[model samples]
Target: MEPTNEDYTYRAGDIVYVFYRNPHTQDVANIQEAAVVNNPENPNELAVFLYETYYPLTNEMAVYSTEEEAEQAYHHYFGGI
Candidate 1:
């Protein structure tokens, strides 16, 4: 199924920045670039390719279209580093 939010939609090949926390190191969180692509399990849905994994794209994900925007959000949420 598609994302519940109607205001945002990502197409295949779109580059988005997301605030990601390292799975192995829970203390490390940073902004990372991800590629939007069709979900392998569901062609009609979109997913983000990052950290060598595929994640479903939803409104809940801290996704931004540009690095500057992502940085601003990162600083706002993380406060530093």
Candidate 2:
């Protein structure tokens, strides 16, 4: 039930939360898909090409199992109606 990398589309100005598996941590970041390099040498992956809101940080993008979970996290971190 986990969201696959293909499920999410990187958009400019889209706020995202990344989750690292090794240490198990969450990071809020912004999407800069436009600046991402998609080439043979530099393979383009959604999780790897993201702009971290907090510098000097390393965490892979979290994949929520459902849209509700993602929305809840987004609301909790960014506030919502």
Candidate 1 at residue 64, lDDT? 88
Relative to the true structure, candidate 1 reaches a TM of: 0.86
**Candidate 2: residue 1 lDDT (0-100):** 21
Model 1: per-residue Cα lDDT at residue 39: 88
Give me the displacement of residue 26 in model 2, in angstroms. Answer: 20
The lDDT per prediction is 0.83, 0.37
